[model samples]
Target: MRVHLGSDHAGLDLKNHLVSWLTEHGYEPVDHGPFVFDALDDYPVFCLRAARGVATDRAAGLDSLGVVVGGSGNGEQMAANKVEGIRCALVWSEATAKLAREHNDAQVVSVGGRMHTLAEMTHFVELFLAEPFSGDERHLRRIGMLGDYERTHELPALPESAVGLGPDA
Candidate 1:
């Protein structure tokens, strides 16, 4: 699998570690930014690029998933979710990681560097990557709704709209 990665100063070390680990584990890890950390560095730059890259990869039929990291991972998650076609989940545990993929069909995971050990992070990320999204009808429906919401803020047009089609009835 090919994975996209990025981080700020707070997550720099962990991101570097993940790059090697992903490669060693047979994943093509793409690093986004902050090769040399600067305290003032921002997470948006790298996070956005990484997220877009992964989204593009899947769009281009090259890859399927990605992992993003930062100090709290909140901003990174928010940024990643901004990408079209990316379902990004902020995962802090193995179970959540698995559920994010299995239930939410998350294509990308966000990890908080200050929240857990390297081993824990690795475990969560592995679980996320290993799990497959369950294609259960309800789950698929919900994902579709979310995609619809992302593209068009209006609620899905329904047969109910026909009820009021007659003007001034």
Candidate 2:
């Protein structure tokens, strides 16, 4: 697997660490980086590139994924999500990491550098990379709805059970 990584100053340490770790684990790591820390650096600049790398690689039929990091990881996640065809998940725990891949089919993951220990964050990434999408009917249907909305800019119709269940109803 090829893992693309990006981060702001706050996440530089973890992002660098992941590069080495990914390589040791037999995965190729592509760093879309700040290279040197700058406190004013923007997450979007690097995160978008990493996300785009994953999108491009996958579109070309290669297996690839992305990891974006930041102080809270919120902005990085938001930035990566802006790329077309990229499903980036903000992961905080083992379950979220696994679910990001298994349920959401996320090709990118975002982690908060200030939120967890080095080992914990690394473990989450490890789990994310190892898990496979479930491909269950329900999961595929939900993913399809999201992809459809992304391409069409039209909201999906409310389900029969949800149509009349709002508070005003």
Candidate 3:
């Protein structure tokens, strides 16, 4: 699998570590980063590029994923998700990592550099990379709904109950 990584200064160290770790794990790691640490560097600048790389490669039928890191990972995930066809999940634990891939079929994961120790964060990434999408019919249906909504601005019709109307109304 090919993995694209990006981060601002706050996550430079973790991103670097992940590059080496990913390489060691037999995955191709592409660094789309601020090669030199600049405190003022923006997460979106790099994270978006990494997300785009994953989306493009996958669109071309290549197996690719993305990782975006930041102090809180919130902004990085937000930025990555802005790219159409990219489902970037903010992962804070092993379960979340697993769920992101298994349930959401996310192609990108964002981690918080300052939220956990190196070992913990590394484990999260490892779990994320190892898990595969469940591919259940229900999951596929939900994913299709999201993909369609992404491609078109139209919202899915809400059930009457969901819209707060009585069932018979």
Candidate 4:
């Protein structure tokens, strides 16, 4: 599979490690930026670029997916998610990685290099790549709602009672 990789200085070492490992594992790893480590580099610059590439490929008439990383992965994941058509998941474990892809259809797995060992990170990547989205109707509908919100900034038309919030008195 083709995977885009991006990371700030905090996650640079892990990103580089994954790139070399991914190459050896028979998967195409595309680097988005920060070819050389730079302390001043920002996660949004590289993360958003990677997310855009993955999201645009399918939109701009190609097919691709990606991964982004940083110290806690929280900011990077949020940054990537800001890009249209990109679903980046902050995965810290094998189960979450699998669930992110299988249930959320997440195209990008965000990892925190400082959060785990190199072996754990590798396992997270393996789980993410191994799992496929279930494509169940409920999941699809929910994703659609989020997409709609992305475009309109309006509340989803679900029953407020079900979501536990009655009409705003």
Model 2 lDDT on a 0 to 1 scale = 0.96
Candidate 3 least-lDDT 10 residues? 160-169
Computed on alpha carbons, the lDDT of every model, listed in order, comes to 0.89, 0.96, 0.94, 0.88
Sort by lDDT, best first: 2, 3, 1, 4
Name the TM-score of candidate 1. 0.90
- Which regions of candidate 2 are displaced past 4 Å? 165-169
Question: Alpha carbon lDDT of residue 167, candidate 1?
Answer: 55
User: Which lDDT tens digits does candidate 2 get at residues 45-144?
Assistant: 9999999999999999999999999998999999999999999999999999999999999999999999999999999999999999999999999999
| Tens digit of per-residue lDDT, candidate 3, span 9-128 | 999999999999999999999999968889999999999999999999999999999999999999999999999999999999989999999999999999999999999999999999
Candidate 1 per-residue C-alpha lDDT over 69-145 given as tens digits, one digit per residue, 9 for 90 to 100: 98888988999999999989999988899999999999899999989998999889989989988899989988998
| Lowest summed lDDT window (length 10), candidate 2 | 160-169
Question: TM-scores of the models, in the given order?
Answer: 0.90, 0.97, 0.94, 0.92
Best-fitting candidate, scored by lDDT: 2
Ranking by TM-score: 2, 3, 4, 1
How accurate locally is residue 54 in candidate 3, as Cα lDDT from 0 to 100?
99
